[model samples]
Target: MRPPPLRRLLAALSAALATGLAVPALRPSPAATVQVLAAARDLPSGTILGPRDVRPLALPPDAVPAGALRENAVGRTLAGPMRRGEPLTDARLLTGGLLRGYGAGTVATPIRIADAGVARLLRPGDRIDVLATPSPGAPFSRTVVSSAPVVAVPRLRSDQGALIVLATDRTQAAALAAAGSSLSVTISGAPAGPPQNDGPR
Candidate 1:
């Protein structure tokens, strides 16, 4: 004995309740997270990672970097620079094949930066343009290497000078060697580091 409108209302409410219950089953679950090691500080290439250099992080599965492992990464050298908090991945670690893809004439060369301040600031993977004055007090102003990648920035020694590794051709290496003590450099954000001197390659 229900009216047509009343019967329709009852049917509509039943459908609404069914939809609300069904939606929970259809809802997507939260993605799982993985524990991985993340850099604790800005790490330059060639740096030997230490216990304090990294920390564990819980990251979403998809956000985890490839080759990332939760195991201790201490003592491993880096082949590339990493920003603080960046995930430490296998590919970024030092490997023999790192230089396999370089263009012809590329060679690893080490030079000493005259300025300790600049040398301290240089990190591996940094790009530096080499300039030489040719003569001191005259304007250290000749281009030796243009936009060369810093392969390594070795830890500075108290007595031993700071050494910066560069990727360049043999000829350019010779040029840098000759510029020794007269070379200067420029970097982004800071007055460029002093030019490198001829040091062991």
Candidate 2:
């Protein structure tokens, strides 16, 4: 027989090898599940997303075999027939809420147009400045506010044209709508040149 210390060391080595082999089998395998956005109505460009825009989606949670991408793995796009009653991982979810609010205005207080047509021509994510002339006689104009990519253009209605909705209190909304109709809301940042006067030619 070997010495006492040598025999003990051999037993320890055997135990260690056994544990190493068992570890691989004990690990859980990946599943086939992913998250997706729920069906929602058309949200305005600058509208905020509440809790209604997100829902869970389930796929074959057991279909993801070993050595495959995990169900909870980030950036992995899953495309297949999904079924109910399976667990879903929320890795690729998207929300439609802006970081800041817009369009809430105050009453009866005229919100001047800052940069005129800038708001009307903006896309969903375009940055723009809101400039308004307080009055025709006012010496210099003022920049009422500045926002990023928050304007919502009217769809399929050329007659309505583009509408500029500013972020103001309830009263300001009424005031802006009322004042904008009469005031010449000239969009700024247009090709700078002499004004084209259309007199009877």
Candidate maximizing lDDT: 1
Q: Write the per-residue lDDT of candidate 2 for residues 1-201, one digit (tens) a residue.
A: 767998899999999999999998999987656444432333322223344432344445465333332233332222111223223233212121321443322211222223345435555434334444456766754444333233333232223233433334443333334444323243344332222222111
Q: For residues 1-201, what per-residue lDDT tens digits would candidate 1 score against the true structure? A: 767998899999999999999999898987799999989999755577899999998998888878996986888766556789998888766544434556765666666656657777777667787766555555437667767777666564434345677777777778877775555677633233423333322
**Which candidate's TM-score is highest?**
1
Candidate 2 — which residues are off by over 4 angstroms?
1-121, 148-151, 156-161, 166-179, 182-201
RMSD of 2: 16.0
| Cα misplacement distance, residue 123 of candidate 1 (Å) | 1.9
Clashing residue pairs in all predictions, respectively, total 4, 19
RMSD of each: 13.3, 16.0
TM-score of each: 0.42, 0.27
Q: Model 1: residues >4 Å from true position, as ranges?
A: 1-100, 134-137, 188-201
